[model samples]
Target chain A: MPASAPWSAAVGQGGGVLRSVDIGALELEAGGELPTVTLAFECWGVLNAAGTNAVLIQHALTGSTHVSRGDSEEDGWWEGLVGPGEVIDTDKYFVVAANMLGGCYGTTGPSSIAADGAPYGSRFPLVTIRDSVVAEARLADRLGITSWHAVIGGSMGGARALEWAVTFPERVRRCAVVASCAASTAEQIAFSQAQVLAIRQDPHFAGGDYYDGAAPTSGLGLARRIAHITYRSETEMEQRFGRAAQDGENPLHLGRLRPVVGGSFAGRYQVESYLDHQARKLVSRFDANSYIVITEALMSHDVTRGRGTLTQALTRTEGVQFLVAAVSSDRLYFPSQSQELAAALPGDVKVHNIDSAIGHDGFLTEVGTVGDLLRESFFAQ
Target chain B: MPASAPWSAAVGQGGGVLRSVDIGALELEAGGELPTVTLAFECWGVLNAAGTNAVLIQHALTGSTHVSRGDSEEDGWWEGLVGPGEVIDTDKYFVVAANMLGGCYGTTGPSSIAADGAPYGSRFPLVTIRDSVVAEARLADRLGITSWHAVIGGSMGGARALEWAVTFPERVRRCAVVASCAASTAEQIAFSQAQVLAIRQDPHFAGGDYYDGAAPTSGLGLARRIAHITYRSETEMEQRFGRAAQDGENPLHLGRLRPVVGGSFAGRYQVESYLDHQARKLVSRFDANSYIVITEALMSHDVTRGRGTLTQALTRTEGVQFLVAAVSSDRLYFPSQSQELAAALPGDVKVHNIDSAIGHDGFLTEVGTVGDLLRESFFAQ
Candidate 1:
């Protein structure tokens, strides 16, 4: 059995009761060995006698393990779907949401001290999505979860859930991959590359070992700005900010201001301010090193790396049921990709659509819709 | 009359016979005064005795006045459309393409030296798309041309063409706006803000005055990468680089490499390399400060600003013939925006669609289709 401990999130109070365990060393898919491996998770309710009532929920990129507020004061990211009498109903099923490996939320990651007593920093080995899933399986074993009643996730989390169904088919009885695909598309990798470069290009990054110095907050902020644009839809941005200037500033009237020594770049548009706010929020809480590591892991998300073709890899889950869904307006992971994933699965699986103008983030924002679908489909089984 | 001179392009020999004239200082739209303004232009063929056979072709952002090769040995950006026997037949009409006022190609911009013998840098006053059109009008006055046979452009160039039809409707007999909108949308502004921030955040940028030092190449590169992604379709990216590692390097296998001082961020995917190559090419031939100036001008693109609603703004062009077109797969400038522009126009305007899988770039890549449409519509008229 693994030893358990308590920890809080980088920002808000971590929802529910947080627990963690050192899952021992991990052999990474990219060749290096992670000397130490720890998984931080949050659970609600109790496991049934048979332990088949356990449901594993994976969090998206930059997300925490908090699914719904339990004993903690913080409101969960998915507050509408995982509580008592809710879709994933913690009242009956044991809900487990673990912060993926390489995550910073109470998890052992790049920010964690290595065996050499120094932060992994630039020395942290690249961890793939498959490697993260393998580490999570060890955590599942330690938790006495021989098999899960359901595995559910969206976005990066959905990639994890799909990996769970393929890597350890017997462990996941049912899977719901929402607003995600079986593999990271080239476009996804391109975006990820830019985000990673944004963080790394910061002067203060100091080769990723800036623990004792100023963190690469600017780079982190820029990365978040790039990412926040992708998360929301163009329609939403148009309706929200339009070409309107911020309350007191005018993007068109910047010339009247006195030029400062460093070139005063004032007069931000409302949308620019919105992006700045997002960047500032992320920089305050998230670790830059952890961000790069996690982003790289996400970029390495391919279910059929060494598992032959996509169909052959998915054949392992022939008996497992799936509830695949895609956000209608998701530009990041298009609905067509979801259709492809669904067609590759056993039987005639249809991709459920979450109709929203919220883009790729609909899986998190349209909680009621997600809850309804889960309640009627995967959870119903 | 303006004085004509000779100047070679920073890239290849500028297409056609390049010429320039000092248009003098002018008042800016954003409440400022430019002390000096010069417009660089290239002319092909000859103006008819009446001077009514002159056609103005505007170039997109990062594009030069060189539309089609004539006296110069270099290939032109629109060689397919404005050749001797092409749609806009250089043999039959005087084809004129001008570098925008804030462009780097022999045009007055942030890179231009002020009266103080120092580059404008960040101290350069903001120039709008309208201001550029005003400067171009001065150029027209000096060239003894009263009206254009037709004004045509795509993307930023398209934005310029729309401005010409509205700002000086009497001067443009026919106009073609391709893959562009009358105003900069919130989404466009948001993307522009990110690109601006990317440059400003660069440590080497030095408040936009990095001419004497190492320029913010990385920042400019990041901005280009971001912009290039939006320029093409997701399908194209998938078809082109799909998860395949770059030649001799695997993005997923970076961990086995030695943990060098700067984290040896060496292993790049093929897509990343492609972006890097694009960045390098631009850095070699383009000025970073000029890029910011032109980008800001494009972001400030709004034909309706201070001119009433979109329909009211377009009223000036009631009698002018229009050939509006949109790239079918363009995400940056959606077909809906083209539809909006077409519907708001005075006549029964139909937005010609340039069908291609290349997205917004189809306006540039689908030359045959664009040519056919121009020949069938406004040019034919």
Candidate 2:
């Protein structure tokens, strides 16, 4: 580990291009090896002469590496924060974002080909957040980045960002863990298990190797529906949908069977219809096997795993500038969790509050507040 | 609606025994009609000379008429609350508990036979909580009871108790609605929808008509698992099983395929294992079709459905003694909702708090607290 690496060989290979590279094998923490690991990433700006201006940004579960559109026509998820003049300022910093190890994007996951040249599917080894961080580290090494100016992320991405600081303290100058905790709580694990079971119970799942035939769309849809409800606040759902019936249809009449226009009473509440839309959208864009793999990895997230304690695990990143925040009304990851994470950190860290009525999804929706916090805490210097 | 029917034909026919009788047809509030409605009820103690000492106890979802061990040897779910010397005091007053209309417990529900001699199955009409209360009223009429001394219920049962006070204020002297809200909140509806969809998504569901073949036990199990999480507190889950793996099995290694004693790597976290046990127990004893029907009916619960406002709906129960209480840690029905229901009542009705860490299930688990409250309020009289 060096203080900085300048004039490295892999500096300008991907200046601002969305590209995929073989990061090779990943030795998992749970005693297993992924024969081949491919990471899909996007890079922006150029590595400075000192290489200290490089920044790493991680995506949350189901999120891709497209942090901002440099060459792609589609807009990124965090478009507000990673543009040229935005808080992340890709024009001034060499910014990089990678899809997690078990992601469905271009990353090597359950959908990817195994050593036998067939889809790994159910045979894909269990991956943890630490394993994904390790894979990303190898990618970081190739890109000639010795130390990052800031590693920014929220939710699961925040977990990864925090791991980067702990696992490689000298390599991460600043860490911003927003809307996440140091470890997955029991409630979080409980919800995740339900989602996993939802997929497993589907007949079409075929042990997660349904690629040769009909995909387990129904199971994946149900998983998404469950997750979507947790993502948004209950107050927001009530205020938005209320007791209103779906457009021109009444859920009141949705019995087991009745003589209706569709020959079945499939009408739903407005809120149910909204969840259906989300499920349908995810089914079209994501892989069911990958969703399960990534979700399990997230469930295995424990910053203190194999470490002495929460304080001990976090103690590795002693003097790193920390910016932790939480969504005020988030039931999934409460503000109290962020407060706990902040208190455990060995620094004068205060958990910033993102005041939004949208629950856990507030971190993504209320980007202006997140952007402001980032600019003040890490970017200002 | 007579003042009394002491010599009614249905009286003393069952005589403190678990019995079923046809209550005839029911016209639903939403629409349509049930051709014939059968109610299964259990009575304990005597009706008294004046028939004024009768107590009506409504059971929650999945609950049967067996509130205590009287005619049956099996112990009841609320054995502590409804025993001979308990707060409810079955020895001093007549106590009656009925299975909900759409329930599987000997009641005419989705599992009942239709005119075609086949199971109602998918053809079962939509039922509301009000519809259930209406059917129970007919049963009360047959039992030679003009008015109930007090109506006691919790959870969905609480909704029924509140409905009794509103629909027939003259018939209910005291109403104890514990751990339930006046209306189903958006969050409640959202969670309920997920559970319903879980069952419906099962390939074996066969559009809710799988009685002739394999039942949708997997789907029903998943639904129960989801609902079970909402029933208990996050703190309780953490304290009981905080990322602890199941006995002799590590959830971290629970991949798609691995040679183990369990035959697969589906080993779960301790919390997940607990949920699996709950799901399995419900599947063995309950009907999936009935589960869906009752759940939908619960989602349709709103005391002020057609009524103008909360004040208007509750105004019907003027002069009724209302005892409103909530589980302090309840996530499903917040204490604030109980406060709202109490505020809408005509008199000064304050929401009593059941101080327990059990969450929404507190009303069922903390029997001593509820017993004390009942003795202090309605039962003592």
Each model's DockQ score:
0.57, 0.59
Model 2 spans with C-alpha error above 4 angstroms: A1-17, A254-265, B1-17, B254-265
- For model 2, state the Cα shift of residue B365 in Å: 0.4
How does residue A285 of candidate 1 score in lDDT?
84
Every candidate's fraction of true contacts kept comes to 0.64, 0.67
- What lDDT tens digits, residue by residue, belong to model 2 across residues A190-217? 8998888788777788877888998888
C-alpha DockQ for predicted model 2: 0.59
- Single out the weakest 10-residue window by summed lDDT for candidate 1 chain B: B2-11
How big is the positional error of residue A97 in model 2, measured in Å on the Cα after superposition? 0.7
- Return the lDDT, model 1, position A378: 66
Report per-candidate TM-score of chain A alone.
0.94, 0.94
Model 2, span B166-263: residue lDDT tens = 99999999999999988887778778888887888788898878889998988999999899999999899999998888897777773533333422
Cα error, residue B124 of model 2, in Å, equals 1.0
